[model samples]
Target: MALPPVLELVAPHDARPPQEHPCATGVLPIRRISVSIVSLVLLALAAGFGGGLLGAWMRATPPAAESTPPAAVEDTQTRIRAAVDRVLPNIVLIVAETATGQSLGSGVVVSQSGNIATAAHVIRGATRIEVVLANGDRRPARLVGEDSPFSDVAVLAVAPQGLRQVAFGASAALRPGDIVLAIGADRGLYGAGGAATMGIISATDRILPRSGVNLEDLLQIDAAINSGDSGGALVNLSGEFVGMITSVIRDEGSERSAVVGVGFAQSSDSLRPVVAELIRAGRYPRPRIGIERPDEQHVEITADVANQRRLPVPNGALIVAPAPNSPAVRAGIVAGDIVLGVNGAKVDFDFPMVNLLKRLPRGSRVDLAVLRGGRTLTVSMTAEDQ
Candidate 1:
């Protein structure tokens, strides 16, 4: 038994103590368990909050059908067409034949008694005139009278039976940016009638320069005006005639190119006074002032009983040159005398010649105050009509 030497056995407690269960008390294990529970709770709350936010977003947005409404629309074409229908019957296409053929323009029936108004250049030197109605009836027209080359306006007469007269509107009150519509025979051809255009009044009181006459009181607009639109009506949206389309503008040397948005019209004011005179008189008499140009500065002198000082001048127009048998000469006014006054008022070389001439009536006597060399003198003279 001693030979085996006996296997020695260690006690459980004394043997290399069993390796401790290392994971049981370490920080890593407890931390991991706590993290797992927290992650599950966080995910549940996140899901609930996301669902609430999405529901709120959907509730706040408006539906497409509830946001948009039906709109009320208007027919502009119907209104313009109605205006044209009411006005076209009152418009006429004017044709005037000259040696070079015919000039085309437009006119309006201004009177139930057959009077028509148009631009003078349209009917200038016309051998004959023709007027065409909207219904295609053409008739011979007569130029009753014209007020030119002072004003480029003329009056024509058409048969009154079937003519439709347009109602005149007040052009004096028109302001800038007011919408205007114009109608005219855009082309020169007969039965072509008129076309309608729309724009606004751009300016007023424009001065137009032409041969022989200074055209004033012009109505400027931006409507499209063509060659044959002269004398056509520029009407308001209310369908009333506001002005007459009379001219179109183009740049110099550009003949074939039609311009855009520029036109002018003769105002109804200028037409009224002109038309009234035409209806009254067969012609407008040109006004004139009677006077003759003096070759040298002339002085007039006259004698006054009231002159106590020995002044050289009193009264009378003195001529520096002997006007042969003229009123100044016949009035005993000699050369080298100073003209002090006419009709009791003093006159001198510094006085306006126009005013002196204006003050002296033709076939009237003028008293002049004058000074000759050293002697004051007064003279009575009769003015001669020029």
Candidate 2:
């Protein structure tokens, strides 16, 4: 981008080049000088680029990306290395031998019991499935299940072995600028299966509707996600898997359709339900509990809110109202009641009722800890279909 022209001194009588400025102020249209380096400095002619390198560098609003300090960059490298070392063992190359050709991609073990989470399109219409572990050990895998095309997530099952489950990081807490690493096999099930690339989250809650695929609540990242990167782990600096790399944006402007450029991931926060249901029921369901949570505040449990309500807990979903003849109403829950837990899982600002509902199957029973008038009570109800 071009920089705006620098403000120059104008002669009182007529405009002349800055080099001809008469050491006297009488021939000038004055602008505020931030600093006079020296009285002699102003007395000399302002030689444009030849002698004003410092002034050019100090120009306001230069089109420069934010730069990281050397020390901070070194620290980031250290963190990336630690995250990769911890997560690499969980990333595996999935080779789905379809009737047409071999479909290769990456997959992350979601459970210690040998359930793997990968992109549904990666293993679509497979005749035989094979999982190549990080150490190059091959294991026969079976098609466990897949979610809706909108989710693009599939689950595979193999015999239980010594495998690591990725520590899931809360995507609900992710910010746009958070540093992340994309670990996957980019066109190299033989060599690139464990490759890692680092980038920042470009955006969150992105919706992409293109070419018959409609996905929602995606994490758009600036990382390189190539052909085989689908279903790979998107790890945070904390060495936690925060997202699953799903699709790459490659328009006609792409370098031969290679989209290692901009990519999207299904947020782990949004995956808890999809992954859980695919493992249990082989599909995703729109589960509803008929309780409305107030969407007013990002942080619902501020110190001020806690003090004002005189609530016993620091974090919870304050029930605005329960739908009439709904599960919450049937469970005796009402407005002014705070839901503190879901089936023994604490309900905080981070893991609120919304996420809890998504993680539960539609027909599952719910145990909620409700705080009403300073007393905690237990309530139970079956989750009805939405």
lDDT leader? 2
lDDT of each: 0.69, 0.79
Task: Assess the local accuracy of residue 385 in candidate 1 as a C-alpha lDDT between 0 and 100.
Answer: 39
Sliding window of 10 residues with minimal summed lDDT for model 2: 292-301
Can you tell me which runs of candidate 2 are displaced by over 4 Å?
A: 1-71, 189-193, 252-260, 286-386
The C-alpha local distance difference test score for the whole of candidate 2 amounts to: 0.79
Error of 1 at 287 (Å): 2.5
- Residue lDDT tens for model 2, 251-331: 656445544478999999988778888888876664556663334211245456789977677887776656788888877
Q: Given candidate 1, what's the lDDT at residue 150?
A: 48
Q: What is the C-alpha RMSD, rounded to one decimal, of candidate 2?
A: 14.5
Error of 2 at 176 (Å): 1.4
Return the lDDT, model 1, position 70.
32
* All candidates: TM-score: 0.54, 0.57
